[model samples]
Target: MRDRAEITIVGAGPAGLTCAIGLALAGKKVVVREWHGDVGHRFHDDLQGLENWTDPVDVLDELAAIGIAARFDHHGVSEGVVFDGQAKPHRVRGKRPLFYLLRRGNAIGSLDRALLDQAVKAGVEVRFNDRVTETAGDMILAAGPRRADIIAAGRVFDTDMEDGAWLAIGSELAPKGYAYLLTHNGRGTVASCMFSGFRDQASHVAATLAFFERHAGLRMQNPRPFGGFGNIRLPRTAMQGECPVVGEHAGFQDALAGFGLRYAVRSGRLAAESLINSTSYTDAWRRALQPGLRTGVVNRFLFNAAGQSGLDWLIERLARNEAGDTLAQAYRPSLPKRVLFPLAHHRFRAPLIDPSCNHENCDCVWCEHGDHSAAIAGA
Candidate 1:
């Protein structure tokens, strides 16, 4: 490898690849160092989502806007059944898709493999099995999540169930987080995402499987377990030792729903634009994703406070047309005050006042302090 380039990225994940491709297309020399042999190696074959709830534009259009052609095998899903702790399933059908389910791997049509092909065609050089710990000069850190507030235990299996998605909201299955199952083309993933009470993760996953078997009719055969974690804290700065951190490394994740694809792509684009224009990456991301991210933080605080009953209420409200309209209004930038203000002011009580953070695994600063950090940063 050359000693220097116009830009060097540490990780070849979605964010790093996007930034490297953009920079290379702009006539800049860009090189990416990935610890894995190929793209999406860490994700295995787990099913992930490109969420569409936060933005009004279709996910395909959004990816196209950033110069990504969505040629991968993805299934658009707008309808799903939400089950509460009581095991009562509520049907949620929206006019537009809530999310698109896509496979995460280096398979023929996987998102990561597609992006890698585009990057190579754009003249971006990628060094496989090259793990970079520190760097100098103009660099972008996109090494994925550093710390996790929630751990998701997932399994890929062959199932006879029809292609669809289902979400379970309750402490019994997922603790403060949520459990989800998505199946497409005979492949399925069952995962339990938990924010607290992690000591019983196995029990939780077992319970989640049982719940799905009972309510969603999940039939499984061969199973392979894979897991991942999420970082959900407000970022203090975009720079990690002069290198601009992109993607989950900068905490560019959804605080409420753990959807980071949009944020990852958006942050990568912003970082590339900042470097090209000689602007600050920190300022650019703040301008692009700030207020919305802050609102998500507040929404998460309230959601965690609401517990199982609150989840039930949210599912019930989501079924109504008026609530759908309200959600659309919340997405508008002009209605910032009207959108998340009610969630913060709602009279909800936490089931546990002080949590050990699952045996001191999570810091829970955002949860304990609420929006104080955002206030200090003027978010």
Candidate 2:
């Protein structure tokens, strides 16, 4: 049976929209089906969260590629304060005094408009308020959490905490990552827990409130008006078969950091290019995320280490003038092989060691049989 469209994309997030636009630009017949009544409505209001973003240039390039380059506005910040659970706060400023912050809605709106326009111009069809119950031909799933149903079932690691600025107080109450307190256009503050676990979620919230009380000394006793929503990280293995998955559907979100805007856009473009050119999905995945995904694994391992204390150490280290640049440089994957190999060894090797070497009667065959055989041969 012939497919209805050459490509069918489900979802209208950054990934889906970008894919639609890219494919349309390639002159492929594409149909973007969005379940929502209106585009960009999911995050229409209350986008207050931490805006300490990296990769502004890449984001701009993606926007330009999709024809929405004008919507971006860069916010300059002189310094960012780091607060560990018990340590004194450390302040770190950048030499350039510039970083990127944007309203999520604005970015989504721009992409949505540009994608819809391009799709129409290229004679592609777009269906809004239409839910795709199933996918047939060259399906691209970018539906975030819902994509789980379309693919093989995978475990979901949930950390149910809000993401916003009010989380500064007792930010230690969460897991490893930072808490954010942000206000959009002076409407109201949004308190958030970026990467705390569900088990510690309530404690994180209380500690956040306490932190605000102690530092800001403001007792706004009203409950937070906004609820929390989490972005999930899908396993890379989820895209194992014929069709390709893009955006959050493929689990491109950084599990440790919860920053996925750029990743989603980039991955979407890659997926679109692969589909249009008849390239392999796995090759597209690797080419699109050759370096970022590897580093993300290392960082996620660090975030899961030593409770939240280790995270505090990392944050404090970054707040120091010298250490911040070093840490930031370390995160970059473009480092020379001489520098990269040692860092990779340091980050990944120690975790690979087994602690049960000394335990007798343990089930580890290598320690028991292999070691004993070698010792007996020496006799």
Candidate 3:
């Protein structure tokens, strides 16, 4: 497979698959190696949002512009409820759809599954359970987060409740992040996304479940727990020697929230285009994505400083205006944020020093748990 592929991608996640599809369609032989048995193996039919409010263009339209079609199932959500610290509900209405709800992981209708099929159809040679330790020639590292800056722990289950999106934001509920419940077609997902206090995630998840159960009339039939972590930071570079690191491998994640799908997909396309054009992937991503990602870091800093009072006030303000407009501004780089960028960078610096990474599960990195001598393979 190594000798066959003109481009060897180390991960079969969205970034790697997207890169493979683009390259193969351009008549370049592309092969993707996934240590996992299948794509989206980390998630288990978990419901996650493909947020659209941050960018002016709708996510699907934006993906189309980049040549990635929306072949997967999606549920558009135009409005939702946000509950502040004191159990106060704020109705949030977007001018268009706020975000699209889709399943993640290796499931039948998941984004990962869709991308895998698209890559295969595009003539990408995908090798599953292949832990590529070493390879020759061009490679793109798309292995996801290797460290846990933020952790989300929760459950998915069958429910009798109607379709809806509900979120709870408070320091006591979910530390610096938020707790959310997304339900559609009798399936429900409840999760607590916490920015800190990883050890206390259980209590926070329980608190979020209780809050939603009381306020939203939530009901779970057969619940199954699922947990994962995220790493968000503005890296100094996007290159690992000649190999371009896309997705979470490049530390391309949102600071304010844990949304990385858009970044992942966009970076993948940029990497492919750069390789095809024999240009610089670093310049491409910097021009296209750095501003928003920097804004996300600043936004996270502000959120950290605001605490409960600030969060409550934010809810009140979002209640008055269209959520899409306000959220877009929040994500965009402003003068004030530009001025505060240095301080924000100083505060939430994610050097991502993870010594406890047990690579027993997936071949994300060549990390032999505590060792890194054979930094030879990654996906």
Candidate models: Cα lDDT each:
0.75, 0.51, 0.81
**Tens digits of per-residue lDDT for model 3 on 293-379?**
999989888888887888899988997899999898889888999999999888875423333334444322122122233354222
Give the alpha carbon lDDT tens digit for every residue of 1-379 in model 2.
Answer: 1334578888777678777878777767788887766555544333422222344344455467665444333444445455666635666665543234444442443444545555567666778788766556677887654211111000111112322223232435444445544432333333434343433344555565566556543234333333333344435443635567776567665544555667777778877777766676667677557466556555656555546576566666666655425445645666453344446435543432234334355422232222122110000
For candidate 1, the per-residue lDDT at 19 reads 91
The top-ranked prediction according to TM-score is: 3
For candidate 2, the lDDT comes to 0.51
Name the weakest run of 10 consecutive residues (lDDT summed) in model 1.
Answer: 370-379
In angstroms, how far off is 159's CA in candidate 3? 1.1
Segments in model 2 whose C-alpha atoms lie over 4 Å from true places:
1-6, 40-44, 48-58, 72-78, 95-99, 105-124, 146-172, 194-203, 216-224, 228-241, 306-310, 322-327, 334-379
- Give candidate 1 misplaced runs (Cα > 4 Å): 1-4, 322-379
Which ranking of candidates, highest lDDT first? 3, 1, 2
By descending TM-score, how would the candidates be arranged?
Answer: 3, 1, 2
Q: Kindly provide the TM-score of model 2 when superposed on the true structure, using C-alpha atoms.
A: 0.68
Among these predictions, the greatest lDDT belongs to: 3
Whichever of 2 and 3 has more lDDT, that candidate is: 3
